[model samples]
Target chain A: MNTAMLLLTYAVVLGAVAPAMLQRASWVERAPRLAMAAWRSLTVAVPGAALLAGLTMVVPASPLGAPLARALDACVMMMQDSYATPQRVLIIMVALLLSVAIITRVAYGVGVELGRAWWERRRHMAVLRMVARRDVRLDVLVVHHRAAIAYCLPGRGGSIVLSSSALSALGDRRLAAVLAHERAHLRGRHHLLTATARGLRRAFPLITLFATAEREIDRLAELAADDAAVHASDRLTVADALLTLADDHVLPGPALGTTPHDTGQRVRRLLKRTPPLHPVVTLVIALLAWTAMAAPLVAAAMPAVATIGVDCCPTR
Target chain B: MRGFGELEAAIMDVMWAAEAALPVREVLNRLRPDREPAFTTVQTVMDILYRKGWVDRRLEGRGYRYWATAGRDDYVAGLMSSALKSSPDRAAALARFVERMNPAEVEELRAALEAARTGEPPP
Candidate 1:
């Protein structure tokens, strides 16, 4: 019971407040890869801790070390003995149902999200093979369109796509930067991260953390990829490539997506090239991320360890 | 790197290039593969395309003639229109890089997108 409360408190505080704090942090703009790691860790850890808390309530945490069958038998006996009253039994049942419900929703949401993406990509790849020709010089799929465009279709046999006009518009340095950006996305497997974010948002639409994580991951991932582009060409050149594409498109429009600011930010971030966090700061951040993931698992296990020690080495 | 996937694409190219439906034998002769693809292989691939609804086929003169279901340009146009839409597309198939500035202009861009997709506005 104490273990359950401890975990629940951690989950509540982390889930309710961390996203707001993270979003406002200026340091993330300087250390985007770290930001991505933080978000991914939060996604796994928060819900996980909640689920474990629920499980701790559903079953009595008796000492574990006997054979599997005997251990489960002891657990079941403890659950029945401790929850003798109707109200307590009902509470335990509710916790079990809630845990199962969360598990089901997450599984279904992720399955549908990932499955839908895979199907759409397969269909797109087939049509792309028919329509776009592989460019010999650049080795990218080229569509003969005037709108300056560049993107990557990521997954199995992933390929970068560039519009013919983008080809004509980007000079050597900018083109190299652009290619590196798209390549970084593919190499880092950003799509899986994105798809999982989308899935979690779908599963938990009302949760501010999941919603914020989805947007933040999408935003920070671009920054992370831009950092990769810095290796191929200077940051200013990458900024130029962004502006060139923005200028090339003649369309005046108002879909002002919730995140066109991300593009604006990307360009600004490149122009000012903030130095990465110091190694010690980065290491400290890494340790914090590890703690967020590991703490719940340890908390959940502590009950079992306590029970085991009491049973095996009785104090005089 | 190109394998059966490239062959499928090559065969589609042949169908798209033709003015009218052509028999499997003609497709085989027209194919410029690194190595010659057998008549049976061409027929099998065209059958696959027909099954996939990428091609329309008719049986005439003891062989089937196949033509593309839609013009190559139309397919590319549809793809461009959807791909150009700003982020978090339902499928999220394309990780696009068109970014930044000028908010009031989006209304015009939407209309331009619709017009370009419908009309044969080749860039």
Candidate 2:
């Protein structure tokens, strides 16, 4: 396989091992979103950088490209036979790794700085606005505007500010429904997803799929929040609030419910959802994933895998 | 005051109308003479009111003086306005809230919004 494929495989190996080893039970429940995000990252950002680093190493360490190397070596033989030296491969790999590291560090710093600044600006404005405090202290700050929705901002105290517009827009019944939707985001701590998406993007800038996954998971988070709002109040009121908010033109603030895809798409899903995965199905899926993930390790530990495989395959 | 429950709203209405805090006895005296409540009941209600963060009390000699923590109109206005600001789709949510309200309630919301927009008391 090309270096890119190999590196992507390596990354998948690392990524899979981490969650399987360290993931909590709740995290397993959230796997659909995380899995989609991982797949998206793989497609969008991983391949190109891995290819760059892998090619740099593979091209030089092995004598496989003799024709190409010899031709290039001849041109520089008089002055610098050193041009085709195997050390170039090592240098290239190191340089690629260094470049990736520096770029990631810079991008992460900038993204964090920008997110913090944006949230800080919102905090100042939010304090001046008067709103009723909900009973639970979820590190959420709600400011009422015209939209009947909720959203979370990532970083720092990441408050979910609502609008006076949304409050007065929804009747008390619907308003309670909407507030529950926002509260769900705080409870689930979906801001962590934003951070994950941001980290993946920073690390693997080329992955378009990661962005799609991030956006989709963000939308799904909204669906989950809608379900929460439904639980807190009437399903119809929450559904109506979602519909009304979908028609709203207000731009989302730094926190959660402000995006176009999140509002409309989320409401639609909430209205149509069958119950989420049954506990048994979810457990089985979790077990199956972990088992599939561990199969390679099991095979590696047991040299009898060939015989076992042969017996299982049975000449077919 | 117009749409309030008995003792709690009445106390607030008195506090809002008065320029200064009133003693429990004075507040009790001001109520219609035919409908006198037990002084202790008034006092208890006032205490409950204070606990709801609706009123502030200061001890004076053997008794206490009570005043509203927020004006009746201001508290309702604040509640309404704050609700509007807390969601993502505020304007539409608010518009829907307004649209779904009964005529009288819609009128009040409209008046509130207009007053808020113009920075004036509702006429």
Candidate 3:
């Protein structure tokens, strides 16, 4: 019971508070992949810890030295003192309901979103293959559009799509920067991250952690791609490419009313040449994220840990 | 598979340019002179296109003549429409570039970029 309470508290605190703390950490923009890892771990840790805490309530502890399987089986033989009271029985029932609800909802949300995205991409690809010309030398799809647009579709059929106007506007090096950025998105499978974020955020809207995951993941992904683009082309070229496309796509009026947080920030960050965090700091973040993901499972197994390998008779 | 896709786009282009449905012979003729594709290859690509719903076909005389179901503009529009949809699916940015920024933001971005390009501090 104490272990379960500890886990429940951990989940609640992590879910309710982590987002605000993370946003304050300025390194997030500098180390986007790490920030994304942190968010990914938090989403898993919150639900995982909650589900485990609920499991601890529903399943009674086994005899000393018994394994986890034995403990699970012991639940059916509910002659344990833990289940003796009517209140205890009610608590277990509620906990069981919660665990089941969490598992099913998460599964349904992610499954439906992934499937819908796959189907949508298929329909889009069907049209794209027919309309777009394959530029084997550039290794991208080219569409004859006046707008200077660029994008990539992700999956087996996915390729970077560049507009004819965009092709003419950018010089070879500037185009390389843009291509590298899109390729980075594809390589990182950022679409899957964005899709999963949407699923989780919608699944648990009230949970602040899940609620903010989609937007943060999206912004962080673009930053990460920008970072990757720098490896191929200098920051100045990437910034130039961005401005050229923006210049071509700019409309006259307020139809472009502000949700300009990401683009503006990306340009400023590139211009400012924000220094990346130290390698040691990045290593620390990656380790911390892994540890966060692993901790919930350890907490959930606290009871089993107490029972296993304590064969005192053998010691005697 | 790459060859088939290239051929498919090539064939579709001929159909889009033609005033009416053309037989496989006509499509092969319209293709660039650098590479001459076989008549059978053109027929096979149009067959695949018909199945994929990009083009519709009917038997004229002995051979099938294919015409695009939609124009080039419509397909380009379809691709752009999905990218531009304010849906959550586009959260990953189907277009890795712009995401419909306000004109003010675009201006701000251009100013910042210009400063970077010219090595001048922002005014």
Candidate 4:
């Protein structure tokens, strides 16, 4: 009964409460890095808690509260009985199979995405090698396109590509800001975060949590990159470069660049300084995030704790 | 130093520079005057290029002659355009480089570019 209740709580929190709570948590925007960690924890904790809850139900109930040895015997007997009954055996088999399927599916999704990204990056590199000229001064690949485009294809030998239109589009200062933005993406390795989020969302599109997490992570990566860019260049320059590139179409595949959706919001954030999050608030939130992750397992283990207590203590 | 990628690029360069279609042996001989690659290697590369729509081939005698269908500049532009098209999420991809702007903002950018070009103060 305790196991069942725990399972119910886990399901409710994972499927409904967590997603809704996160959606309403406006403060997440202020502390994106911490919020991202919390979201990641929830992603793992949901499945982990569900699995533990299922395992707890499999263990037989001890009414007399036997000691360690007797309890072991009861557990062994219950395990045998669980397989002896066709219905219980089928449930266990289905649960085990489902877990395996979910794990394999996510693994396959991640593998495919990474492989595709690598392949595309290789092809882009090959093409860039042929046509793009080395700009020794700027240390970026200069392509001859009239449309303004600036992006970086990330890898060991990745190059930052800029179209001729981009050179003429912005002044020297604004150009520096754009370069700083692209460098920030490469330095931060934001592509990996976006790719992982994409893989998770693709693997589990039905899960509202994965979808929400992917969107938030995508936005946060841009914000983080913008923050990095702002460090090197002034806010006005970055904001101007952003507006200049806003209308230009982006070259696709695995390349990360300065332009992102929500330019208006980013520009506004850059112009208006936001107060730093309080350290106590950040610490409290971090603790709550971890606690939320651990609570399910703790709930599932309560009966076992009681069993251990009864075994260790003797009542008059 | 001369991998399949380099070989493909070499082949494209020869075809793009040539006035007319070149045969397989001719393409190989033009690649490296010092030490030429095997005929089959060049043939295979050309076939791969043809399949990829980078080059067009026509039956002439025992083997086909290949030529670049697009100019080098057009080919590079196509590559750039295709890269943008290849993004799984167009919005996310563009967001990496720039943010989405409304018509008013785009107009502002156009005006700014014009001002920079004509020596007028930016609006």
iRMS per model, in Å, is 8.4, 13.7, 3.5, 6.3
Across residues A232-282, which tens digit of lDDT does each residue of candidate 2 receive?
875445656655544454543332223423343343443443455667866
A1-316 per-residue lDDT for model 4 (tens digits):
4664566577656766786787678777677677777777777677666656555554533223323525465555644665787887777676566557667767876676666677777776766776676798998888888667777777677768888888889879888888887887787776666666677778878888878877777777667677667777765567778877766644333333333335666766665556657999999989988987888767766666675555334344
Q: Give stretches of model 2 more than 4 Å off.
A: A1-160, A249-262, A284-316, B1-123
Which ten contiguous residues of candidate 3 chain A have the minimum total lDDT? A307-316
After superposition on all CA atoms, what RMSD does each candidate show versus the true structure? 6.8, 16.2, 3.7, 6.5
How would you encode candidate 1's per-residue C-alpha lDDT over B1-123 as one tens digit per residue? 376677788888888899999988888878945559878877787888889888998889887878999988888888877777765653256687755356434334434434534554322
> Of the candidates shown, which would achieve the greatest DockQ relative to the real structure?
3
What digit string (tens of lDDT, one per residue) describes model 2 on residues B51-89?
Answer: 868679999999899998876456544544443353422
Give the alpha carbon lDDT tens digit for every residue of B1-123 in model 3.
Answer: 479877887777788889998887878898957568887877787888888788898988998888899889988877876665556665433635656566676787777777667895432
Per-model TM-score, in order, reads 0.89, 0.44, 0.87, 0.73
**What shift in Å separates residue A286 of candidate 2 from its native position after superposition?**
3.5
Local accuracy by lDDT, each model: 0.79, 0.49, 0.78, 0.69
Q: Which stretches of candidate 4 lie over 4 Å from their true place?
A: A55-74, A81-94, A108-123, A136-139, A155-157, A249-261, A294-316, B1-11, B22-53, B56-66, B83-95, B106-123
Candidate 4: global Cα-lDDT?
0.69
lDDT of 3 by residue, A143-217 (tens): 888777788888776899998988999979989989999999999998888888878876787877886777788
Encode model 1's per-residue lDDT on A102-132: one tens digit a residue: 8987898778778877787777777887778
